[model samples]
Target: MTLRIATAGKGGVGKTTFTAMMTRALVEKGARPALVVDADPNANLNYYLGVKYDATVSDLRESLKRDQPPSGMSKPDFTALKISEILSENDGYDLLAMGRPEGPGCYCFVNEVLRAAMTRLASKYAVLLVDNEAGLEHLSRRTTDDVDNLFIVSDSSIVALRAAARIKLLSASLELKVKNISLVLNRIKSDAEREAAISSARDIVGKDTQIAAVIPEIAEIGGMLSSGSNVFLLKDFPREILEPLVSPHET
Candidate 1:
């Protein structure tokens, strides 16, 4: 079964960073056939995964809007052809960028097709990790909910914790849903500081929200994110967080 892990938090909470690293960690631990869905319109997960994106779902949406048909072809056939051309993959995992956002009331036929294809694509993977947007609009609109472990990451601020709480509540209300929601306190300094965020998050999220792990507030770790590379590959960080995620049998 595919383990669907998702990250949710306001922008700059390091959701993208966590998503990339967790994927890398799983891969490094001999987890193959993983998939990472860069669902945010910001589209920065590629940087973390070291992926150079060549196309996006928006490009396909544009093609569908054009609806260009060959001399004798029908519109339906033309649409099918465009859908077949959009999917792409790199070495470690298949990456899909949702691209920049659309207006409030944009047409969505092509988007629906892409969502359907993405669903089928996800089914073929061993693990699927989604880097969510600040408000989790994709999870609501695209029916991409039901994560086995949904991580709500945040920085030092209590405001972020509040936002995570709100997101957890919003996700629960959605008919499309996350099965298990958790939190990862990011950019934590001393053990005491981490303990504070954990305690605050736990208080807000209550018993259902698991504290998955804490990402240290290390200067070099921040530097790695600056260049858009994953720090989870570092021996020490993975040992602290990712290794514990593996089941005993899987080890």
Candidate 2:
């Protein structure tokens, strides 16, 4: 079975960073070259993974919508070819980006083609990690139909926590086939802050979900990211927060 792990959090809460680190950790644990989906429009997962991508799903969407198919090729066929070409292979994972649509026209067709293509592409991998947008509009749209583990990451700030809560609530309301939902507090500086976030989470994120892990802020990793250095080269990563996630399910 393909284990699908999707992340949700407000922008700047280290969601993308966490996703990249988690991918690196998983690869270290022998889940190398897993399919990584950069669903966020901002599209910086490539930088963290230290690879360059030729195109994005959004680029395909615009191209498909704007230009006509060549000769006898159908839209789906042409899209499949383009998507196959855009898959960037790197050391520990492959990157697929979802770019923003260019035109003001409706994107229903674009979404259909992209979602189907993603679903088809996912079948080849053992694990799929998606770095989603802050609001998680993709969940509501069902781009990823079934999620084995949905991680809601947040910073220590109450505003970030509240955004995490909203994501939890919004995802529950949608008809999403989510198997498990958990919270992750990123960039924790002290025990007191961790305790406070855990305390607030019980009320804000509801009873069913739990604060699965608290990641301490690491200056070394921060410096690497700030300098646009490849995280995979860093010998130390937050395994405390990522190891549990690499396995199939947490007990």
lDDT of each: 0.69, 0.79
Candidate 2 residue lDDT tens string, 1-251 = 67788899888998898888888888888876588988876789888877899988876665667887799998777777778788898766778887774545454654675476457777777788988888766767776557788888998888888888888888778867888888889898899988887888777777666777889887777678578687787766777668888788562
Residue-wise lDDT of candidate 1 within 1-251, one digit each (tens)?
A: 77777778888888887787777777777666677777776688887777676777767666667666988997756765564455456665777776765666552653464455446556777787778778756556754565667778888687888888887777777755566666788888898998787778778767566787888875655667566555554544645576565332431
User: Best candidate, lDDT-wise?
Assistant: 2
Model 1: lowest-lDDT 10 consecutive positions: 242-251
| TM-scores of the candidates in the order shown | 0.82, 0.89
Q: Cα lDDT for residue 43, model 2? A: 87
RMSD of each: 3.7, 2.5
State in Å the error of residue 245, model 1: 3.6
Residue runs of model 1 more than 4 Å from their true location after superposition: 65-88, 107-114, 225-236, 246-251
